[model samples]
Target: MSAANKGKSREKPMASLCAGAIAGGFESFATYPLESLKTRLQFGALEGGKPLTPLQALRETLNQGGTRALYAGCTAVVIGNAVKAGVRFTTYDQFKSLLKDDEGKLTAPRSMLAGLGAGMMEAIIAVTPSETIKTKMIDDSKRAQPRFHGMSDAVRTIVREEGISGVYRGLGPVILRQGANSAVRFSSYSTLKQLAQGSVVPGSQLPGWMTFGIGATAGVITVYSTMPFDVVKTRMQSLKARQEYRNSLHCAYRIFTEEGVLRFWKGTVPRLGRLILSGGIIFTVYEKTYPLFDSIF
Candidate 1:
């Protein structure tokens, strides 16, 4: 372990939580436009229109409401992701600490297990409600008679009309998707870091560029592996979810039977664009920021 890892091992979870919040907030702000485009692409078939390319969607969104349209639900996502990342990193670190062996080695499987638990916790505590609101808000933005004026307004309207469960619309798939996402990302990132550094030592730091590359590679792997879950989660959280599908399983089934299997990856391009940068930005920021936190306390 490097001094960084040593500090991390000794530090409390609050350090990683704060560091992760900073990382997640930055990542969300930087990649939100791509996220907006992705959600639109996911709903393309349901929109009853010709499918639009990313550029066309960007043009249309810009025409509709200028750059502001490109960030339709950015505030919700930024705040949600910040809290989600904080929870995820804090729990992941705690889990990892507990899972390490007598030699203090964290095998790939153990790392993946830790990540899985962290993701599930974050999804339930932070991701599902925020995503439900963000999805509905973005959907609202597409309507001529948009109901939501802002994030708080969206939350209020949803709660008023549908009750508290409205904000947890996609809880099932969100947990599944997030669990798989973290498992793959953290494990692959750890393995790649180890391979790059030629060591299996936990928290072995790498150069900035290498860390970014490894994180992006992990993101690509995670995207392809979990896209179907993501599509289902998005559909379940959409404002029309009540009418379109009964539940997460039914939503997935409808997507498969009505749209074809490939529809599960409908937003691949834009999501890929965002996640590639997201993985890099998140890990690099987390790794760099974590050390500062570690040193402080």
Candidate 2:
């Protein structure tokens, strides 16, 4: 390859990785309170009780342990999401490259397929264990006698009590949720960006506002499409998984039969709030940062 082409090749993967890492970590940290709320709502849903509104849940969490309660599992998510997003974008780029046409263009279907693979890859490598730990920590914090003092304590306790399987409690639903999530978000974002730019050209530049808007739209679409899987994933990863849920399907069944279909979307408001912000933040950060990384690296 020409020296310029070789340089571009090297830049692509590294830029994608670094940009995605920063984007994911920043987004997760900024929106962690919403995530904490979502988990608590999902956990509450497992009890098949009257659903708490987002404001009520927020108030209850704050009252229970003050502002710190809202960030009970932030550390795990920020770290895990960083790694997961790094893997996600790098893998998505690789898949996109492979799936592109002879003209080096990617269609929507191919983009979705690439995202699907990327999502599944990230889920197995990072999201599953991270989410399990985060959920357990949040659950423990709700107890009369909380066990884990922090991230390390949570990890040690979970490992001692349940082994590796404990940290991977929701692998199946996580993979499904993430795969569908990426597929919808990435494909829609790509399609929306193209529409906004009025072109299908690769590396087409868009204004920051446009990128954020498109990303947020894509996130909303993703949240609605894959919500049930997300709820099921959270329940399966909870500390009481063995006692409350036989498996992902059983969890879904119970949620549907006992709590009704809407119960599967118990955490929608807070989760939607998070995703809206996360979509805007992650895509905006990644797009802006990638070029800088590309030039520097």
Candidate 1: where are CA atoms >4 Å away?
1-3, 7-11, 199-204
TM-score of each: 0.95, 0.94
> What C-alpha lDDT does candidate 2 achieve relative to the native structure?
0.86
**44-98: candidate 1 lDDT, tens digit per residue:** 7778899899999999988888887788889999999999999999998888888
- Misplaced by over 4 Å in model 2 are 1-11, 199-204
Candidate 1 local distance difference test against the native:
0.87
Backbone clashes in candidate 1 total 0
Output the TM-score of candidate 2: 0.94
Candidate 2 lowest-lDDT run of ten: 1-10
- Maximum-lDDT candidate: 1
RMSD, one per candidate, in order? 2.2, 3.2
